[model samples]
Target: MTSTALPRPPIKGSRTQPIVAGLVTSLVGYTSSFAVVLTGLKAVGASDAQAASGLFALTIAMAICAVGLAWFTKRPITIAWSTPGAALLAGAAAVNFGWSEAVGAFIMTGVLIAATGAIPWLGRLLAAIPVSLAQAMLAGVLLQLCLAPFVALSTIPVYVAPVIVVWLIFLRLSPRWAVPAAMAAALGIAGFAMGQAGTTFLVGELLPTLHVTAPVFSLEAFMAITLPLFVVTMASQNVPGVAVLASFGYKTPWRASMISTGIGSSVAALFGGHAINLAAISAALAAGHEAGEDRSRRWIAAVSSGIFYILLGLASTAITALASASPTGLLEAAAGLALLGTLGAAASSALSDPTSRMSSLVAFLIAGSGLSFAGIGGAFWALLAGLAVRFVIERKRH
Candidate 1:
């Protein structure tokens, strides 16, 4: 007897899922961090046009690097703005250096980051940073930003509560869409509030306008802005980004990626953008099973993300204007909600190991204290404090 055979399921193409994943990743990453970037740029004396141009330049540079590197390496290689570096800038915005000096500092930072690839030991030194300390420092840098939502709720409940509630609901229902959903809610609420208040929230030109700032270097700017920015971008962003790729069984081209990011940062600096580097959180979306079942085909996801990033760059003028129109508290709340996951992950990683617990705690405390000395930020001091504790403790044991 012949048995009837069931028809085989139609095969799905490799490109579709990866492309979707890429687009989603780009949207989430840009929405989650662009506000912080705008705030940071303004703190460093960037005008509205300059800040918009900076974002536009950054997006284009990252898009090129992400797409080119992913295609060349045949692996998902996502690039992102240096969130920690931006946070540092927010804190140091009052520094005497003008916007030109900040631009100069950015260029120097790019040169230093690129040089790490040429000087292999520099990359190794960054890798040698203790994981616990690194995590602690990252957690500390993220603490203030993560607290923004609660702060907004306390101060502006009428505007922020709805946004936070929406975020929490979506977070439980669909984790991947949580931040984007929250951002949409915020925009809607803000728009309604503005309308009620009889405010015209005008979006400027849809196309990006270029703003060029000349670099003016000084030792103070270098020590304060350049050094700290370089450290955070490398230690906090690049190292973790590489580790993420490696964890997913991809052979990361560490030196090559660093070099590419350095060049991208330098080019972006001309347009007032800060540093761009390997992405940590968003990289997972493109590199993992979310992109595709087959690892080899996942590079397409990163490429797709890059393409979308360029589109976002083209729309930076409108985005910048929207950000300007929104209540600052509401924007902060959205950013804070988006970073909650990252904060939790960093805290867990920082305190997980018994051997490094004390040191990590010290680092977290010192960094979270927000103390600055000799123009250098707390993040640097936190690293030093943690290493000192580790060193002294290890020496006694020996």
Candidate 2:
């Protein structure tokens, strides 16, 4: 008799469950992040394709780690394009260097992140930070993205405002179907209006294009991008990402999460991606929802995301088409609306206690100010400002 044993089937549920959940959540989180990253690239004078390439690098790397880890763990441990990393990238690009320099820095940051992940001490240090403070920082980091749709409404009133209203209504009435329904509605309205206006929106007919740049070593770029990326990514993305996994009752090693993210980031950096990190908020959704009562089924979701992301990286033209095919108003509104819960939770925790109130406010303002220095971004400044306030307060008390 043959002695080989086939792997057990995943707990009862469709294998596609996690995949759909991962894609949906990723779409919600990445759209705003992509907008910011692409805008930053433009600010630094990168061409459209290069900017898109950056996004492509990030998503593909994340897909690999997220999918691979999930498959190994038999759990739905989803990773994503690091929003905090993207924010850091925008600042680094604007101040310290151009796309080339940013790429150099990205590789360096990935190394540091990997090292941090490999070292248990750093992981403990990260966890030692007060949970409330972590939540506050997470809130601060997400605030800008959460507000973008409303901000867009001021300029693109007809296009964005209606979608926001309908999304809000759906959010109240049917939370489960809210996102997809709002998305469908937005597209339908936009299509009808465009048709009446005698315009058509269609994906372009173009073959996939690939361009890979070898890494360049730039000390200046490395100095500027490294610390800020390390700080923001750990504080804003990894902290929350780990927290989400914990909240969902998975006890994956912090070292493992960090290592995966670090490796993913490094791999992507080699290909000109910005940075990669563990996802926090959206990950919770994928891990918690109907994908599987058993965590293993969720692994399938992450693997699917990885596959989709590979397609995205290789088929840049197709990726853009998929993103562009959606109505602008719909994408904007849906992203903002989806983040409502996470945003509220962040604000509540940040403002909850009187003891750390001042420090939290400092953190909030600096992060929200959108400041940049020597190619680093605001999240670093905010944390520094908050730590400064905390130190001062403690010093005065002593």
What is candidate 2's CA lDDT for residue 195?
Answer: 64
Q: Candidate 1, residues 87-202: lDDT per residue as tens digits?
A: 76766654666899989999999999999987988767866778778778778877887888899877889888988888889889998788888888887877776677787644
Best prediction by TM-score = 1
True lDDT of residue 339, candidate 1: 70
**How would you encode candidate 2's per-residue C-alpha lDDT over 137-217 as one tens digit per residue?**
556656766676788777667767777777778779976556555555555665566566676434443334434656666
lDDT of 2 at 229: 65
Candidate 1: worst-modelled 10 consecutive residues by lDDT: 198-207
Clashes of 1: 0
Tell me the lDDT of model 1 at 273. 93
* Candidate with best lDDT: 1
What TM-score would each prediction reach against the true structure? 0.89, 0.75
Candidate 1 differs from the real structure by a C-alpha RMSD in angstroms, to one decimal, of 3.5
